[model samples]
Target: MTMDGKVALVTGGSRGLGMRMVTAFAALGADVIIASRKLENCEKLAQFVGEEYGRKALPVACNVSDWEQCDALVAAAYAEFGRVDVLVNNAGLSPLYPSLDQVGEGLWDKVIGINLKGPFRLSSLIGTRMAAGDGGSIINISSMAAIRPAPEHLPYAAAKAGLNALTEGLAQAFGPTVRVNGIQCGAFLTDISEAWTPEVVEVLTRDVALGRCGEPDEVVGAAVYFATEASSFATGATLRLDGGVR
Candidate 1:
């Protein structure tokens, strides 16, 4: 119960790493706000946390790419939980394109909107509130794609790079009160792995010191550390969780 009485608001929290984070917060004695595009999925996880841990869980359907939805999601979380002690921006998208030249403007906007814009708006709104009262934490779920970006992942890599920058910017903006950080994750065998071919997986995993993609559960410890007193002296930092990709 390290986080007893705390409230954690996690975006893209319906599944994958996001769902893992949602479950972790509940186990730490924090009530959770699970948000994503699908309300039913959020609800299912919400009910499970409530039953398993006796923690209050709120389900919110939010398309982070939309400014209006991001605003509504924060309002909804505050309405239900009174305050958000931890905010995790975990939702993201990286659409596939045959070539860089084939990447349409529509797809580009979608990737940037979800990967960067939504977190910007959400953090500005909630982080300000957290800074002014009681203080809280902000965690941005970034990607290693920002560093060793591949051709097909240009837009996604660029967006995550912006996220890394935003992480530092928000840390400074909310400093002396709120702490902000990012988790620069590498390949994880989440639901999205179903889309990876054997060759693709091999190429992605070969250079890692661990020689394998990460598990969703492995991300929980860093997340909890950032959310609680364990990282009280930390902020404006992006921790790599890519299994020592070299």
Candidate 2:
């Protein structure tokens, strides 16, 4: 897939799957906007993409949990690139706790706000412009937890399920010009993988068709398919990327 002169904006592009996608987009010849909570990390990725891929990269500090920040992130992307052809809502938060009883209002709120509300605002804002202008694509990053929730990750799973719903709704809302889709991701060795113990890993892969966690770069192909003309006829679809785990 050749993006040639396109502009791509990715949330949570500072590290893990987000960072890998950012790199893949740049390599495909698209100018990239990498947004995350930390300016330092974003800037580091932006510089590396520019130097290595020779594609323009902008690092913007954004905390998607805040509505104001989401607005600012949209404004900044449009201001710098004039337009964004691809928008990836990949930022997420799933903090670990010892027990479900320990889950608090704050934790639930933060997880839901960032995972669900953030994408809704960003896609509504960007997809509107995309439909009006030259058109674009929006990809929401979901998780398997949305379909099969474990007791430990109930909040995160609920939020991801909301994200899947948002993807379908936005696809209808932004039809013809802007396409909306989702990637229901499974376990991958991202930043959150540090918490996975041997026992946890064994259990996760036991019934999985692929029998292992995914690599960060493995997600890039699905993202590219959604971003480019390849998936022009496909909208409101959610593709699972979780190593075929149910």
Candidate 3:
């Protein structure tokens, strides 16, 4: 799918699935803006993308959870590329893990703020710009945990589930303009896996029909599909890329 004149903004694009999505977008001929909380990491990825693919890759520091930063990110993308044709809400956090009785307020808020509120805020900021332009596509990176809880990751699942609802709501609210959809990813190899042990990985993979964990590039396929004209007829839909785990 060619995105010749498209401009894509991928949050958390410093590494992992986010970075892979950025690469996919760039390969498809979209000028990409990679944003994350770390400026150095963003710059590194942007430089690599430019050198390897000959695509225009701009790096900007942004914490998606912050409203001002989200606005600044969209503004920077507009300034660099003249318009944003695709927005990938890929930044998220899953730090809070506790039983209902043991969950703390701080943990709850942090999880909700990053995983749910961040996408909402970013979509709001970018959706407005897309409306003013000729409209664009919004792809939210959700998790299979949103549909099936992992017990320990209660807060994360809840936030992601709520994010799915928000995606549908926004799709309807901005229909015939900005198309909104979510990708429910399964186990993927990323820095997040650093927290899991070999044993945990085995257990997780056993449940998947593929009997293996996925690579970040696998998720990129979905992002590319959702962002391009291929999915022009799709909206308010959650595409699952979980290797048959769900």
Of 2 and 3, the candidate ahead on TM-score is 2
| TM-score against native, each model | 0.99, 0.98, 0.95
Candidate 3 local lDDT, 156-207, one digit each (tens): 9999999999889989877788899999988898988889899999988888
Query: For each candidate, what is the lDDT?
Result: 0.95, 0.93, 0.88
Candidate numbers sorted by lDDT from highest down: 1, 2, 3
Per-residue error for 144 in candidate 1, Å, reads 0.5
Worst 10 residues of 2 by lDDT: 187-196
* Candidate 2, superposed: residue stretches over 4 Å from native: none
Model 2, CA-based lDDT: 0.93
Give the clashing residue pairs of candidate 2, or none: none
Candidate 2 residue 79 Cα shift, in angstroms, is 0.9
Instruction: Please report how far candidate 3 places residue 131 from its true position, in Å.
Output: 1.9
Score residue 137 of candidate 2 by CA lDDT: 94
Instruction: Give one digit per residue, the lDDT tens place, for model 2 in 152-240.
Output: 89999999999999999999999989999999998898878897799999988887898999988899999999989999899999999
Cα lDDT of model 1 by residue, 184-224, tens digit: 99999999999889999999999999999999999999999
